[model samples]
Target: MVKNLYMLPEGLPEPVEDGACDHLQGLALPSVTRPATSGGSVDLSELPGTAVVFFYPMTGKPEQPPMRGWNKIPGARGCTTQCCGFRDRYPEFQALGVSVYGVSAQPLADQKEAVERLRLPYPLLNDTDLKLAEALELPLFDYDGHRYIKRITLLVEGGVIRQVYYPVFPPHLNPTDVLAQLRS
Candidate 1:
């Protein structure tokens, strides 16, 4: 119920700015299919056009405690806020011929709860097996027996990654940043 403490935590170092995404640009979209929170499945290889896929670690249930050390792991927190940002900006992204999606290593059922609770406009791609993470070589961290993908956004055009937004801070502001990148 509390805001992600790490979004702008006063003293902690930001974990995402240290060249984590340097190798990600121009990476071909991974050919994988995963269940979506909305229904059916989303095939990365089959995305029609420009697609915005924001990858986050996980979302915590309101009634449960987050994974151990969730707040201490830089870039590990704020999936919900980040998703909401994309939700608010879905219209703009859609107008630009860009389809927005959220990806995480959570179960489809958990993702469905988030979609329903947040009223997300887009489907959340479920990657419980971390297959997509392995395919993309995305940053990963483990906690209490679970592995989570680090928060990063990919701008894929024609099935190739065009831009990588790494170290997304203040997670809710990410969609606006993505819009700027697309416009420029």
Candidate 2:
């Protein structure tokens, strides 16, 4: 498929400056809803308590640098590791009284398939249209000259981003962060 205009015709405009989500800690993310894995829609926003949003690069395609994602490198160890980490520690997150969801620019089909492939118990938000990405002003890159999502995490509550995590390297590395958000 051809790239969209959002790309400087092929890539997003370089980020002017990183936002609060980059350095924020202890910020409470709000609940959000996207099309459900079962198809149609589900609204997590109505769920109670604080919410954590996991921002993952598209989990489809092989680790192809041409796809663009973490390290701006194709096929970088991105989604699987971090997500599995979350999966393993999901109970802990649950006890914290916070809901968690995964977000990506990939289409709904991809997100749904990923939920099944990973057997994720939570919902995945499809930001494929990129409205959410644009609002966040994410520092997108062209890997092997192709655009893809950045690897980051957001902690939000009540429609506000309380904390953001970048370079969530070493997947599944969940430290019991009492902070509002733990990206890594």
Candidate 3:
């Protein structure tokens, strides 16, 4: 049976807030250029106006099984669902004058595949080098010899982080939560 990549399994562990992102609020984005699925690269710090950047560990492909004990990790699952949620709500974000970007440590090729497969309107920034993660001190975890960023969302305005959403539970609802904050 093919696992549904867009659905989260029942009883998935919820991540607890660890204050990892507390220092991010009101922080200026660093000048780091990351390759994007849309081609070339984007410097989040140079972007004008409002933007939302959601960081997830990694997205699983249809053909491949997820890493061992993937779902057991508190916040490791649901990347695909999270991305799809953002994709489905892209129009709303655009209408609100906010740009959306997803970042992961995945390579650009993998990100491109996900963009084409998921029909994502916004680009997924490649953070394979962890440049942005290092600069911001984003939460990270190691699994199967690979390092992954924890799920977190940032509301950026004028190159500054205005809001930080850590421990985003039920990843699919994250977009809704962000929209609510943006609307308020």
Candidate 4:
């Protein structure tokens, strides 16, 4: 069964600062369209206004445990909690005229499971080939023979990236922080 790692006594580790990705500011969103857990293609370029795209490493499955040495990787845990945080604040984000999406290098099947299990309102984009990570030069980590994306959030407006939140820690608290930023 898929255990709720978030509730486990040994949950995700605190993220280490990787510095802000100011260099990515003003960069145009990638034109590539990817399959989403919600059963549609997510075309970043097609999103006209504000979009909050949070890149997470991977979501664990109830039937499958995380890869070996999962806890040893910094910012590698808490994908579920992070997704749930966005889910809880989804309506608030919408009220602010913003759209939220979770992106990861995980397969479509894995993402779908997370969405279904967590009842996530937003779609989770699948970048199994690491295309988005490559285009944005997002950090990558390899564990248990699988490549994963690091945790980060991007604020995109009018198809252009406006701001980036790097080294997100305490994953469940990010939505509030992002909401505050958007409001400010």
Task: Compose the digit string of candidate 4's lDDT tens values, residues 117-153.
Answer: 8899889999999887888888888887888888989
Cα lDDT tens digits for candidate 2, 1-114: 443211112232332334524634543333334666666664544645567777766675433333444333522344665666676677877877777777777778877776
Per-residue alpha-carbon lDDT of candidate 1 for residues 118-179, written as tens digits (9 for 90 to 100): 89999999999999888888888888888889889999988899989888887889999999
Which pairs clash (backbone N, Cα, C closer than 3 Å) in model 3? none
Our tally of clashes for model 1 stands at 0
After superposition, candidate 4 runs with Cα above 4 Å error: 1-3, 8-13
Better of 3 and 4 by TM-score: 3
lDDT of 1 at 166: 89
Q: What TM-score would you give candidate 1 relative to the actual structure?
A: 0.91
**Global lDDT scores for all candidate models:** 0.84, 0.57, 0.95, 0.84
Q: After superposing candidate 1 on the true structure, give the runs of residues whose Cα lies further than 4 Å from its correct spot.
A: 1-13, 66-68
TM-score of 3: 0.98
Provide the lowest-lDDT 10-residue window in model 3. 62-71
List the candidates' TM-scores in order: 0.91, 0.66, 0.98, 0.91
Question: How many pairs of residues collide in each model?
Answer: 0, 18, 0, 2
TM-score of 2: 0.66
What is candidate 2's CA lDDT for residue 142?
54
Predicted model with the maximum lDDT: 3
